[model samples]
Target chain A: MSRAALLVLADGRFPAGGHAHSGGAEAAVKAGRVSGAGSLEEFCRGRLHTAGLVAASLAAGAVLGLDPVELDGAADARTPSPALRTAARRLGRQLMRAARATWPSAELDALAREFPKGAHQPVVLGLAARAAGLGAEDAAYCAVYESVSGPASATVRLLSLDPFDATGVLARLAPDLDRVAHQAVEAARCALVNGVDALPAASAPLLEISAEVHAAWPVRLFAS
Target chain B: MHLDHNHTHDGPPAVSADAHRPDGRRRALRIGLGGPVGSGKTATVAALCKALRDELSLAVVTNDIYTREDAEFLLREAVLPPERITAVETGACPHTAIRDDISANLEAVEDLEDEIGPLDLILVESGGDNLTATFSKGLVDAQIFVIDVAGGDDIPRKGGPGVTTADLLVVNKTDLAPHVGSDLGRMAADAKAQRAELPVVFQSLRAEGGVKDVAEWVRGQLAAWVA
Candidate 1:
């Protein structure tokens, strides 16, 4: 894929309203689960391994032209929190709008029309990757990057960390990004070869709990 | 370009997404307006732009968790030029981007300034967050907390930080007070009691050209900035 394409997909500036979310980090922070950079890193790493892994795998499946309805169901099942689920669909819809505009494709438009509300981010990202002509690995990379980067970036702003130091943390996670991408592609390949309808199941129960608690706070920095 | 045997790319060089970024010094004052869901935040933003756009070069960034509904609303109203307005679909949790991780919001503001050239103000409208939703100081220079009389007359008495500490507290929808059974006097008293010396404005966006009073306040802030 062209570098411009990759930039558009990963640029935090994209019109996909990712700014309004903490990716569960806010909830984790309020619950005393994630305090500092190290704890934040650990929390994000866990998400990358669990939810991030699932998102990557599903995105890979999408790149391989799997059914979006099936993918949507699978994603819904993995996300137990109604708040988180609602969030994912909202993000997915926004991503679809930008993705459709930048990289027009019939499949994406059809998916957007079919599931107007409640489409998960991974499903739409996968379709976008396919439309952008990115390979499964790149698709997986973008998915994981989007998932983790938002929270990691949010933590920096929330905590008022040095911007340079924050970038260093992101740089350190580069290796993990590669690892998760490879794992996603492998999972996608396995699903294809084995004819399994199920995608990889990896979810964090604690994140869901935190999200719910965060939702009820009288004063909070992040939405959820 | 020949694909490398290994997974690493050997084709064209990967474009650094953050490369050659514009000078950070000359950016506009990114202001985030956040409050409860449907607290007239969108209405406030639209009114502000309509009132202030001619005086100052402006752009807007709106965060709508699932839809571009707010952005679309502004576009439909023609509050600002289409190119000057951008929406960030936050996916979920409107407070996160405004307060927790502001990269996306920051980037959006910067991108607008980059495309539109130097802007005096960039208003970022957050998706309706709860009473607690506040913008991270890192993302915005000033913040506004909005509440409508229709949500509840006692909302001011609740006295969350957003109601108390935001640069300004806007008591919107006063015109609806009679219809909604909200006590305008009690709300104003509660807000003044809780806010102490902080300023508050009660206006009916539907009636008073919606944004005139708040627009004047914004002008005062901008004047102070220049001073």
Candidate 2:
């Protein structure tokens, strides 16, 4: 697997439709749980362990040769919010376009043909990682990093928090990020043997509830 | 290697400029309008829609920063049916949606085509942003950068990507030029210096047939696209 290819897949500028989304950070910030850089760090950490962990595991599972359709079902079960489901599938379709253009795998094409609307984004990320000459771990790392990075970047805009502070928060969370990515790969490996049911179903009720509220807002910065 | 072999060229494309629905029909020509806040990007889209709706099938996609104001305004004016106009939220960075990361905008255009398709043209209007903001070639067949005379005549002299690289530059609100102390001729000359042979249209939507030149330019683009 090429390290350069992994970087290309993980780059925020991957043109996979990530910028328009704040993950669940916009809702958290509006709820005042993420006002300043310090709070932003706490919010990212929470998301990293829960949504991030689940997403990473799903991605790693995809790389482990799990059925994309089944993994998509698992992803939907893990994500409770309908609005977030829409965002995930929407982003998945966008990533499909970019990944297909970059890697052009039959697997990616089949997925696109199957879910013309979209599958969950993490599932596509794993497929993209495989197509990019990357490993399950690379897919896991991409999912975990994006889970926190989306919110940290959005908080910088939402709260006008110091940009350096946001960067610092991400830097501070690197150790935790590493731990979650490692755990996700392990979970994926286990799920490969034990079945997709073994994948973690961690949920953040607040993120789910807040996502629905944010979706109903007449106006918002991020799409979800 | 397995990775290299995994991606055979025989499969269908993931992304391409020659976009097609699964059925193999040609998609509508996408044109983007970008400019600074209140420079009349939305107004240009409205006028273009009005001018071409009778002649050609048309739809619109608007990227609004933190609001649906642009889409709402167009819908309120009844330029096109509400179904034909879609708004994409830009997350406060309008340029990012049009230039750096165009996934959302692409989705909006494709969705419009899917819901009300076989259309001839789709106008993508960008939220108000700086001079550096421009549309990606992947997103639009051509782009028009709109700047009003009231913004300043020297804006043309301070050429950025939008001024030089845009397929066309529109100097809007010609009626406001005299009142705002702007020199239209000097602006046009500066525009020429910045863009060697590219076209620039001075327009005032308030005037009758104000968007005529731009509409004609768009017709030429659609002709080329079909040809």
Candidate 2: TM-score, chain B only: 0.93
lDDT per residue as tens, model 1, B12-94: 11111221222423346667798898889998999899888888999999988666788999999998889999977554557
Off by over 4 Å in 1: B1-227
Cα RMSD for candidates in order: 14.6, 4.2
Task: Give the winner by lDDT.
Answer: 2
> What is each predicted model's overall lDDT from 0 to 1?
0.78, 0.90
Docking class of 1: incorrect
Estimate candidate 1's alpha-carbon lDDT, on a 0 to 1 scale: 0.78
Model 1 lDDT per residue over A1-224, tens place? 67677777878877666766788887776667777777877888888888889999989998887788888888888889887887788778767766776788888877866775538999889898888878788889988887788788777767765667667767888899899889999988888776435578887888887777766664455555
lDDT of 2 by residue, A1-224 (tens): 99999899999889888888898888888887888888888889999999999999999999999999999999998888999999999999989999998997989989987888898999999999999989999999999999999998888888888899999999999999999999999999999999999999988899999999999999789998
TM-score of candidate 2 versus the correct structure, residues matched by position? 0.96
DockQ of structure 1:
0.09
Best by DockQ: 2
For residues B1-227, could you state the per-residue lDDT of candidate 2 as single tens digits? 01233444344433756555444667789999999999998988988889999999999999999999999999999999999999988888999999888888888888887788688999999999999999998899999999999998999999999999899999999999989999999999999999999999999999899999999999999999877
